[model samples]
Target: MADAPPSSEKSFLRRLTVITQPVLTRIAHGSAPFITTFALIHLTAPVMANLGGTSLASQVMLLGREYYQTPFGEKYLVLAPLVIHPLSALLKRVLAPKPARRLSSILSVTGYTTAVIVALHFYTHRVAPTDPSPPIYAVGPSELDYEYVKFGLQTWPWRSWLGYLGFTAAVAWHASEGMAIIWNTWLRSYLGGPPGTKRSRTIGAFLGGVLPVATGMFFMWREPLMVFASHADRFRAAFSMSPFYWY
Candidate 1:
């Protein structure tokens, strides 16, 4: 067997955990509301697209994006939580005195997966189009609408279809678990009880059923032309910068 850590090292690690645990917990918990709010708005777009049409969906999305996409809101509300929550959770795990429980482990996996997917989604839609160095394309928030979404879906198996499916499922599952955590820890008194397994599973089932259907409905419509057809070359150039270019 390998030798144990020296006593001094163990003492230092214990000290570090004491210093950081509360701060990390606060960050992970405090930032959750912002993430949840954004998620609710983002998820609603697909559903509205299903019920009303792509135009309605675009309107819903734009309403939310107008605020969160602003510099201050994006920095403090969206980007910071996206980066900090996962990092805080990770640090907590590393400093933990023992292994995480099974549910916690599952949450970690889903949470990390969520961070990657959200980052990629933000970059592809928001950043790549506005990138300056190579000057691939110059679409701003006002220009991105259902047409941009339909362009992605139109590419079918090779582009974004499966990615959307996975995104919906992963986000639903992760969000359900996060809600459960909030109820159990923060709102137990007001809510009267923890979200027991039955209630949690019910929420999971509801999200799993609804979100994918919304995603499917989104794919049903077709854009009259590909995204930025008049500027196809620039669109392609910007899209090519995506890590999921071949996805």
Candidate 2:
């Protein structure tokens, strides 16, 4: 007979489910897409900003800079979600006695950990305000005069490519896995079905396995991306203002 699950794992899962809903497995099914959607919306500001606004990452936030800063972004978006969503799921499964650990689980932990560290990094190593007087707000990275990106990519205090790759893997898996679950369970039901159809599983496999690998590889090859895009006339003309990013 198989050994039972660890007591701690059961307790953790129970507590987590209580904190979430009764359907612990389905929690990811719902929250993953919600979180990923919000996160994408939040980060898209930088891309939009690069296209439109004066270069400002602080503006990469939800509301404009009048109301909040590093503290708020770090807490609500990064820390709370880590606690509420991924960490709880991780503890529930990783601590279980059965089913030996897997690479997917390991990457999720690494990615979530990277998210926390990066959040804290932004809070602590915040860009200085362009103006230090009353009614002042902190400046964004692009707004600042520092060449930190080049420094990190080229010299000491290297950028966290490893952490970034982990983040990509984590994000890709969580987002795609959640999507796959919804597609498999919910959509298959719509078609009048039993579970575990080959097509549904095939879709799930693509989302869970293939997407993460592709995304991780992209981050790992980001410099090449920058280089390749650099030669494009449209991109070059648009981003010509930046010294480091001209590529």
Candidate 3:
């Protein structure tokens, strides 16, 4: 009887170790973002919804929700990438034990936590699977738009707004930092082994200056971008209750 308990504990621990092995490996590498565009898109789109000027949130919300109405969402761009960024976060915490880089730790932690939170919110608050998401300019009662409205209403306060703004800023920083690392570590070598310091600083400066401008453009013009996009794909995306492709 005494040996049975110890044996059971060992068995349980052995299973745990087996399960955590892959996660630990990923965390050690933290290269999950390298394969998927989720790292950048997740940072940019959600932040715009949270911090971009007035109309920006609504546009982004519509695009995101309506994306599900189409069949493509379940594919690489929408759902797949959304799910990957956080799931791939396993490597850092499991293998590293301690965060090696402060910036990376912050980004990965916040990204993982927020991804779960957002998923939960969608699970709990999202409309029916058959529900059609309308565009931002839709009139009448919006069955598909309620979830995003709720999200925006919750963050209306100055305090909430500031917190989200800070988070978005951190996301931008983390993404830019990642790109910088890629440039320094990989791209530098490809450029015939150019001087590291000058090129790196130049690239960093360019990214720093352009992030805000790009964000502004994205925030203000999501509708136009999506309109252009939907034309190519034939997905009906609009603010009305009966959007283009509600299937």
TM-score of each: 0.85, 0.44, 0.42
What is candidate 2's lDDT per residue for 82-144, written digit by digit as tens? 455765566546644443246556335544664565454343234223333333233343433
**Candidate 2 — which pairs collide?**
230-247
Best of the candidates, TM-score: 1
| Candidate 1 residue spans exceeding 4 A from truth | 1-9, 102-104, 133-135, 198-223, 226-228
Clash count per candidate: 2, 1, 7
Estimate candidate 1's alpha-carbon lDDT, on a 0 to 1 scale.
0.72
Each candidate: what lDDT? 0.72, 0.44, 0.43
Q: Which stretches of candidate 2 lie over 4 Å from their true place?
A: 1-22, 49-78, 94-157, 160-166, 191-247
Backbone clash pairs for candidate 1 read 158-247, 159-247
Summarize candidate 3's per-residue lDDT along 1-247 as a digit string, tens digits.
3445677877886677667755544442354453234434433444464375435544654565454435675455545655655554554345443544564454465555556545543442332223444333222223333233323333233432433344444444445544555555556777755434544544553465335534543344333332233322222232112211122
What is the Å distance of residue 149 in model 1 from its true position?
Answer: 1.1
RMSD of every prediction:
3.0, 10.7, 10.5
